[model samples]
Target chain A: MVSEFRIRTETESNMAKQSGSNKSRLYVPEPPFRPGDTPDYSHISVPAAHSPVRPDPLCDADETRDHATSLIRVMRFNGETQGDWVPGISPEIKRTALRDIALTRAMDERMFTMQRQGKMSFYMKSTGEEAVSVGHSLALQDTDMIFPTYRQQGILINRGASMKEMMCQCLSNSGDPLDGKSIPVLYSFKKHGFFSISGNLGTQLIQGVGWAMASAYKNSDEIASVFTGEGATAEGDFHYALNFASTYRAPCIINVVNNQWAISSFQGIAAGEGETFAARGTGYGLATLRVDGNDVLAVYAATEWAAERARRGGGATLIEHFTYRKSGHSTSDDPSKYRPESEPDVWPFGDPLERLKTHLILIGEWDEERHVELLESCKKQVRETYKSAEAMGNLSGETRVNDFTMFEQVYEHALPHLDEQKRMFAQERD
Target chain B: MPQMNMIEAIRDALDVKMSQDSDVLVFGEDVGYFGGVFRATAGLQETHGLHRCFDTPISEGGIVGIAIGMAANGLRPVAEIQFADYIYPAYDQIASEAARLRYRSNGDFTAPITIRTPVGGGIYGGTTHSQSPEALFTHIAGLKTIIPSNPYDAKGMLIDAIEDNDPVLFLEPKRLYNGPFYGDPHAPAKTWRGHELGEVPSGHYTVPIGEARKISKGGDVTILAYGTMVWVAQKVAEDMGLEADILDLRSLLPLDIEAIEKSVKKTGRCVILHEATRTSGFGAELAAQVQERCFYALEAPIQRVTGWDTPYPHAQEWAYFPGPKRVGNALRSVMEG
Candidate 1:
């Protein structure tokens, strides 16, 4: 059968040659810097901070077409605030933002250590992309719903969710709100307006739009904010969410946290080659903004702008937070195998935490002594929270999730089959 | 009571539910202005206004995903997939997001969305339009799969589904949209105008989900079926002069196992039927359940009368469809045993 198929293919090839048809070739996108390559960002155009003009929240989507390609940055490198995008808040607010960002980093560090120590199954760290989640959380109202991926645990921390509860979730202990049903780091806090985190990527984008649509349909001022990585923009759900948000004018902020990597695959593989990820929103007629995610001020200002637009019924805004992933994708990933270790250090957008800290110090609201004190306080708080969470029970401990509880929430009312199965399980246990 | 087809009954259910509860919104591709290609949502947009019942872009994932979000936000959304065959695009959203939302969140959030889509293969829709994908949903833990055979059950069960707190996949058999199909295509198509099951009430009513309705009671053999296959089983039993206890399983997931066990134990024989492909179809689950529960009773091995393993072919549709002949053969074989 194989030889006969080969002969037919040869005949077809001859016919194609006679017809003068060109042979089709497949093209796969390759990232510029690989494992051993010396990474360079000189080819990337880093515009002056705050160069992109901030448009009116209610401005026409077409007026912001250039914003998709241009970068929106609020803080300059020398700890100076620049341009119209700067969120002119008091020093106190900046200090709070810095504290939240630092605490998020500190929590990520501790949870990552716990996973490595065999206390939890896995972990994902938003090491350098803190501004994207913390800034947005600060900008949006606590009432507005948030649909977040796993990496945005910073949102919960900034929303004042219990550090102990968050740690317990990571530990998959008895105190875990999900009863250890979900994997480690996939947290769900409804009271904090944080949607349950799904490990499956790209599904929450449309749900966010739908929530926003429901809010609008009910004439509620509360909007929704959703986040995904740059790679998930290729998922059909992302495009579908964009189209629905634009058509219905759903009051939502669609954020693409373009941290430049999805696991090992680079942004180019998700069709982020010639155009920006924010540019993909333009085709859906959404107001789009590409902001320097490392700039916490820019992140906050952009999220506030989008939230205001959504509240005033100006419709959805797609904001691409351009940043870099400093750590490996997750506990399971090893970035050294795919990309150069030097890439994170040479990333055009510097660390979000350092940038915010520098801005605070340059403005005379903070100093090296206070920074050290704050870091120590954050580490101590995380350590205490981890201790409290570990007391409830860790994944490796005996006080784990009750196996019989698995049959409890499958439905609101118990069915006969589930009841029978539960009885069987109880019998076996007894 | 008024005579209504399955489509009209479904529309009436949506209309009634929308009127009763302002939080219940209906939207899907072409379901707003056009009232759906199947017309199951006709007049809903005009009556409920655009915000309550609106059209969406042609994106199945978006449709179901948006429904999940809406449900999470305390709105009971009834979204329609144009056809069950087109539901694959939204499978991830349904299986991963909608089904697991409540469980994953530990009851912090719930997806009370009703996804209504026409299913089955008698309309010559061939591969793309003809499909019975209920088994796929039945395999999922959190989703409630309901397939109603007639207009009364369709309307009542749909209302029940929308009111339920969990996600429900309401699979409407398209072949029985306007009438009853008793497995004979050539025997002039019958309308639901005069049928007893078509006499649906105009106002609010609900046929409880997770409960099966015994269409006929007999002693020889027990037939388990749902949707279009229910009527086909009834016709086959009558034609073969077999004393068959036909049970219409309205809900597939939270199945009516008690009713099945009772009838199977009494009859001492069982025949499962569905329009889906034979391999790993819902019939397989039914047969397995019956065997597991009724193994002590001396009886013939359960028979499954279902569509062929091949895709629903356009040219050889009858060959692929498990018609009355196939169902009758199963019944005769079980009776002989």
Candidate 2:
């Protein structure tokens, strides 16, 4: 046995050491553009319009794997709209949608300026993500509830929520429905089928599912839709909602507004560099779609498909609105500190407002003169609404919330201790 | 009326409420098919059907999160954490989401949820299984923390908690599930038999929250205890034949301050007892209140008998527990002063 044994060579140990050095290393994702760097989106590969496969609305969840990976684009770069994802929206609805989007932008611009002028404490503008909410709102029924995030102001604008009420809320005036308890932009309209917005991110996801389950339990035809940013998808509530929705076959649509940035962090920090947020759905056995959030038609069509699926008892659909945050995270944030200052201008998806307007013009349904006149009118309306809202008071304290209101709604029926506290507070005031 | 222990009383209360309200749901890990670890939810799924009572994944955070959502959306959700020690995972949902829903939304929306969990230690379940976290929840403003000492209180308080339109933390003393434990670990346990506290009504009833019960009235001293500590203090008082006023503090958050002040003023001496660790224990709050209210009537500094400041030990459970000997010694010292 000793005579038959072969001798080991020096290259063998060297090869082992070389293989150890070639082992895979940990991966850390960084955005393509950083501060002072040139913005580059060439790494993103979007398919041509109508190129991705489309499964039926009621198809098995397993069949949506390819749809999750591919982008469902309806409006091409040349302003031509041609695709299976192009919804059959009438000219009247299209005009209304465009008007509402313009109004939202105008309102946002006014509120942002107000924050700078110290009229409001804070504001978040949905500069590039308007179509995600507006189109989805147009697709859903009036009775269907929506659990929205702070950025979905377009939903309220599209749903005909009063601009005066919105401005009053921002002002935290006496006319504010929440009694000036909530912060600016966190609106609640229970009668309008809009659940209250929570400042803690990702809470609305499960709330939406629970509401849908309640609707189903009541044997109603209504459904629910919830929205969150891509960074919020990393939250545990989002995953919990997916599991509950998939297992219970809840009738709801979960949306991820992938606007690329979350405050100081990028979307890559949410573990989204390797795959689309829409892919998160297919992994949970859900019918999912990745739609061009800039294209109103694409957003409308995908939302309609998902809602139809939910209504027909096909369970939930997760839609990733492929878009970018074209502004700072909020009035308090300065995006220039992290990302390149010119990134928004060089964004590949283009502005949602611009794309929708161009498509309408190319189809001969709209013109530049009408668009400008509409913008001016929207600005005038916002100005008038802001004037009335400020008369009630702004964040600068021309008016204040009634001290008694702080103790009024803590509980439906105030406990003895609360009543005593209220009495003590009144005595102190006296 | 039928005689039953705290565990059965809790289950019966859930069954009664769920039977009346279709919107009421009882769900947790192993609650449906397995009927829960200690069988607190036994026969619920069979009686209510899986639609109303079902098992969820082993995710405490998800359990509380979904329950909050369900409660906000027209369902009266009673979600159970397997144990009090496991509730930290769901603390955010309970504290931030459920508790603050109505306050944050200014009454536009509310999360009326009841979180049920078995708490405290007597069984040798070691550190992970034995933690009394009543103070953690009691510190939350919008939450109602209720602890039940016996069968009757358990059923009545649970029913009231379910009906209350706020998030309620219903902590059931697990060691008292089948038998009454009165501080002496080696003493023969008292089942519902021959105990008046065991005779719970089969029909629906409610014991209002934020009210304390005067178990025994005397002019010598006031002994404030709740949950298992109530039994321990009562046992020691009877064994020593001490003429003391015993008050059971069922609700900790909206504490029955009037009853506490009345007892402390009458007795002129106070001893607070609980099974939780001494530092920041609920006993501290009671001691503060007693001192503040009865500053002139005090015969001695308010004394507290509580568990040591360490993790609940497995083999040395009695050493850590504020048992009969500890409470007896504290009572004697307060009275002699």
Q: How high is each candidate's TM-score? A: 0.96, 0.95
Off by over 4 Å in 2: A1-27, A427-430
lDDT (10s digit) by residue, model 2, range A21-101: 555544455665679888766555555644476679999998877788778888877678786777888878888888988
Question: Candidate 1's residue-wise lDDT over B165-268, tens digit each?
Answer: 99999999999998999998999999999999999999899999999999888998899999999999988888888888999999898999999999999999
lDDT of 1 by residue, A1-430 (tens): 1111011223344555553355643445667678988987665656764368998999999988988988888888778988988897889888888999999999999989989988988999999999889988989899999999988987888899998888888888899888888888888999999999998999999999999988998889899999999989899888989999999999999999989899999887787357888888999899999888998999999999999998998999999998999999999999999999999999877898899999999999999999999999999999998998899998776547788788978888787889999999999989
Best by TM-score: 1
Q: What's the CA error at residue A345 for candidate 1, in Å? A: 1.5
Per-residue lDDT over B110-188 for candidate 2, one digit per residue giving the tens place of the 0 to 100 score: 9888999998999887798889988888888788999989999999999999998999999988988887888877777
True contacts kept of each: 0.83, 0.57
Q: DockQ of candidate 1? A: 0.77
Which pairs clash in model 1? Answer: none
